[model samples]
Target chain A: MHFSPILLHIPDGFLSTIVSLISWAITIAILSVAVKRTEKLDEKQVPLMGIMAAFIFAAQMINFPVAGGTSGHLLGGVLAAILLGPWAGMLVMTAVIGVQGLLLQDGGLLVMGANILNMGLLTAAIGFGLYKVGDGRKRTLKLGLAGLGAWLSVMAGALTTSLQLWLSGTARLDIVLPAMLGVHAVIGIGETLITVSALAFIFRTRPDLLDPAEGPARGGRGWIFVGAAISLFVLILSPLASSNPDGLERVAGDLGFLAQGKDAPFSILPDYTLPFLGEGAFSTIAAGIIGALVVAILVFFIIQSLRTAKKNA
Target chain B: MHSNIFDRYLHNNSSIHRLAPQVKVVIAILFIFSNALLPDGDWLSFAISWAVILLLNWLARLNLGYTLKRSLIVLPFTLAAITALFSVPGKTLTIWQIGSLELILTDAGLIRFLSIIVRSWLSVQIAILLVATTKFPDLIHALEHLRLPKMLVTVIAFLYRYMSVLTDEVIRLMRARQARSAVLPGRNGGGSLLWRARTAGNMVGQLFLRSYERSDRIYHAMLSRGYSGHLRTLNQHELNINDWLIIALAFLLIAFLQLFAHSIG
Candidate 1:
């Protein structure tokens, strides 16, 4: 029922050490190829790369609300892939997740690979496939397709994460699949709007930059209406998001993790609930709003630092 | 750029830090996998996992204090996941209640929770250690050798390269916001929530626009440099006896933990 601003993903217990390590290894392997691949690029691209990566990191902090008290952030993998090539986009998304894990504590280091695969590669690759399917034709249609791709990928990522939990034997199949699919069905709408709107704007103003593989094409605002209408749908329908336990909870209950998932010892607040902020509908909304702002600020700092570095370099 | 930050975690001179990147990469993954898989109830297995990671930390000569700070971020999620148990009431698990929500913090539950926390802490630390020790490039190089999809690996590398630059654009947008409105402590009249909201909207728009432009530049750059979308990396030297020994030992330890956890669970 609460909107966790800083997404509390992949609770430590759900993943085994081996799972964590293997994923970490996978993350590194991918990252290295990214660097090697980029070695031949101009010095100019390096600074640009840093900036885009910062943008992805910052984007996560700015979340939009949906029904069911659940809000989602910009899963940058798809968008990044569209802008940068899939590899670069994936790396940038990973960097965002990496910094969030290491410095911000937004995601877990143990589950870094999962985070990357989910948010970065899955969304980007899937979205690219869908975008190609639409053939980058009209603006409204292209943007619409982009939004659908974005939304689907977010849900896809969530579903995959749930599967990982199941594979780890931390949760049961019966619980993880249905529950994860449900919440994400709503979350995907929010994702669709944000991603589609952003892409639409870019497609209209600077169609040249969109889809590294495709050339400039007509972009339009009708798609914006589609995106807005979807947002409106979310605005109207989000309140109905099931109060049933999320995928993690469902699995935890059936598997053994439900009992094991505990709060950290050092947090000022016992749960995500703030002491001053009483737990209620009003409080949840307030927290969600505040959480969005907080992410905005954190993202601002990360981007700011990157800009300074660019200048100095 | 901020490539240094990528290198910042690695490039240390300690023996643990100097160990083969591939070996460390493999070991770190196994360590985390085992940590996640180990049953919740066993105290000894958790202790041993912790002990092993701590030993590695000591050998790596990591900045324990600084690393502790880094690990603090994941702490909250770990705490929150267990929140429901404290609220769902029953005669079963250990009992606790928050308002109407009854929780079962049973002895078994508490033990299970502890194992999760310990496992997360250890696994994350090991990751930090891997980055903290191995140069970012070498880690990726090891991965390339390990048969990762090159396309995906290339994506990660690019993000690391460019994320910082975009961060600056965001800062400038925010600073411009504070400049027009009041941001200083004494003059804090203009920085109300509404104003901040307006600024946030503008910033997101601006960010999207700027990112779009940057992509244009990057695309041209990619073509100019003859990026055929295929990244070919120079493979590192093969793993040696030490690497095999490390991998073997890591697997053995993981196996041992699994057996121990089963016996206790």
Candidate 2:
């Protein structure tokens, strides 16, 4: 079986009852908020939102070939979030997913809530959250941020799906977490490329559609906090992944990174932590925080340099 | 071209088709829920649920072979559950030794994996039966009647209405791309993977612009036709005696099935 790990629409029976219920609760809550946020939307915008949902549905059909005869398609969540604001983008995604489940039977009805939560709500939040930082920025900078948002949105979806599977006892955490992330890490690159290109196309043509003033207002810095919380959660869970060394070895072996089931060539954090901090939970978290800070600072400097370069130009 | 295949509803006057959309929707979801709640390796319950699904398919007067084939859509997703075949622990069914590594498959693991496949298959069939028997418009109406959020309902209505239109647009775009992207013998057609992705992305962007423009025209047309903020539908279905009877019967049947399954297990 050609197991494509980026399975977006989760069918039924994979998620346990409790997990499904929780996901449904979370999805419904967020959707209710989205509904309230779009309450004052003009009647004219309704058809536009609907048509946009259809557009996303159609856009997903254009599959580009990847290596080894496998193909990947656009998820369009981040793209929608960029065009529409986060709240409306989320609703559009919900509509698309809902139609997919009810009409096409692409996903299971029972698990549709989790499907929406994973693919619709989370992607919209992350995508719009990160993309909004590019408001009033240079075109390339905005597209770059959108690309980063798109890639992270895919990773977020994969991470949540792995958690759901593990929670349902359908798969082991050690196995599914890495497997899902590893595959999506590559697929996320495709997501980034497609999203950036699509936006670039939009930037060249009908640029008014991307105007923040025309779209919904930004949601402030709330999304950054959400992203931070999610990162922390992932950091907490990273230890569980590294705990099963055998799982990593097997994955490395399958990817042909290691020979004869041997150890990895190198480790970034050496079991996801600094050697000085030792192998405790606290050390792992501290290392993750430090690593995040370093990356953030580097990104800050890069953006600053880009702004200066644009000024000089 | 494949857009028509997505409209799985058969325009038939069978009993299942004649049932109220609300009732069918409720029962379908309940059936899926019951199936999800079934314990792994609960073969008896699985068998009973499969029987119920098959009976429903027969009642709907759908082509059994076609429905079965459509339900196979869930099989590819079963790959997501393949890890369970190796992860679950129990009596060792077999072990494969690759080099110094040992890969073990257990009886419990096999049962768990098979049960997941069966459960997903049965649940998907229930969904198929629901869609096959009810029209998409009626399904939307049923959701509205069931008190789903008004905005969501409206968005779904629009999506269903315009899916085919935009899908055709997409097909045209793809055909255009194909016409332009010709490959020489023993050579790749596209410049590179990135270029191909960019080409597809451009198509998507073009499609979005078209759809957006069409939506503007659609809204104006609706406005001219006296469309207010709220959408009013002609078919307002009330739960009649038969609808109530079917709901009650379904509720009892599902309850009994679950109770019996648990009792035996």
Candidate 3:
């Protein structure tokens, strides 16, 4: 019923040192890129970005009761990305999370890197990637994509948080992953509703703000493609990281990939193996990379064919 | 509007308040890191860390009770670690059968869970002290001096400056909504859940528009005052011998605690 204000912020000592440090490395690298990208911003837009950060910080304080006494609030990552572009959105989210950690103690300083990565970087990337798909599209379609992006960003955040906890040995992957996803699945709907409604309001009122040219530096669609690739890579690797086979097997069964008691017809990465590396963590990671790469290339070709067909038509 | 409720900075002229912001920032971070790195169930090391924190609190002229109470904010989140009680493998302390499932509380799990609580509490105490002792602007300056990206630092500065203003705006919006939506004694106040969420979303959208317009006006005002892209602060803090001595002492204490934690294991 009573929701902790900063529920998603991973506090200190929850994450293992290795996971924390690795998250820090990834966050620092991405933030450096974000900083460089937003470096050429117009002098006027700087204040806008700052106030937007404040707006997000303030927006998160607003909670709408979901069911029972429980409530859910806007995370504002996707909303920010839609208003500002991804780079600026990430910067705004970072500043908000930073203040939440340093001043509010909502998240830990040591694991602040992981918190920022999970809640800010990944959310912004996923949210913006999906939302940008609707660029110049019909109004309803754009709103639909924004809602979907908002929902998925929450899921991505929950997924990464589960992975971090699992990797840190704080919780078993089999238990934490499904539990987190299930709860966030509901919370994410709230995110979707709020983001879509808010975006709809903006669209109706000041349509100029939604225009990419008038916004902060627009991230190229190339960022979307790269984000998609990275997400696919992580998703492919996740199941292998879980020690329990039933988790993946059950998923396979539900997806109709595993028939009754039959073995899968074929295993591209059988037992997550590589011929050169044999069976170990490294082999599993290598196989995941190969699988992700194969899927990405296939999708690329399909899109390429569709584009060419449209041109010919 | 009681906007400063979120800003816990207490006006005091203690030595900790006068210490270099960067020095305090570095020490707080190092202290937290040392605490986090301690092995689970290392009560001795945790005790020593608490002692150090208490001593610092005394020096800062802060009410120990106030800081401890503030640090209790971490308690609810400790629920996230509850699953560790059953999911972790160890010697079973207790076992309960619920329907088709067996929930086992392991000794190792209990130790780890308690350690997480203590570690978070200790770290949060340090954070509360840091924020309470240092001004927000000075904190931002410290971050900039530490070589954080200028643009990011500037945004953080703006965020701190405008946080209260936006917070007041949000409070006003909520008050308006509450006034319109009246509840019976036993039932809900607002419309259907979807409507309520939409209303909140609309409020958010309204807030965004206001914030965007305010930023424009703020920029124009700055420009009128001959504002440049760069922000110059009045205070230029150079680390004095006392600040260096404190840093050295903090480093040694943290190193010693870490060494003690490792030695025990």
On DockQ, the leading prediction is 2
Candidate 2, DockQ score (0 to 1): 0.51
Error of 3 at A146 (Å): 0.7
Q: What does candidate 1's lDDT look like per residue over A184-263, in tens digits?
A: 65555555555655664465456766644532211222334433433333322222111223443454454444433233
Query: What is the per-residue lDDT of model 3 for residues A40-59, given as tens digits with 9 covering 90 to 100?
Result: 87787678889999999999
Q: What TM-score would every model get versus the actual structure? A: 0.63, 0.88, 0.86
Ranking by DockQ: 2, 3, 1
Expressed as tens digits, the lDDT of each residue in B1-265 for candidate 1 is 3434324473457888767878887787777767777776566887888777778778888767767776665575553335323322233655555454444565654554566677777777777777788766676667667786554345446655554566556556656765776446765354433223333434565697777577667777777888665545575558888879878988987898788788767
Model 2, residue A168: C-alpha shift (Å) = 0.6
In angstroms, how far off is A264's CA in candidate 3? 24
Candidate 3 lDDT over residue span B1-265, tens digit each: 6666568898999999999999999999998888879998999999999998899899999998899899888887776777667655578899876544456788887887888889888988999999999998999999999999988999998998898899989989988998998889998577667678778888999999999999999999989998787578999988889888999998998898798799978
Task: Name the candidate, 2 or 3, with the larger DockQ value.
Answer: 2
Q: TM for chain B in all models? A: 0.82, 0.95, 0.95
Q: What does candidate 3 score in Cα RMSD to the true structure?
A: 8.7
Q: What stretches of model 1 exceed 4 Å from their correct place?
A: A1-5, A16-55, A61-73, A81-197, A200-204, A210-313, B1-11, B83-100, B183-235
Candidate 2 wrong stretches, greater than 4 Å: A1-5, A215-218, A231-313, B1-3, B98-101
Q: How high is the CA lDDT of each candidate model?
A: 0.56, 0.77, 0.78
lDDT, residue A42, candidate 3: 78
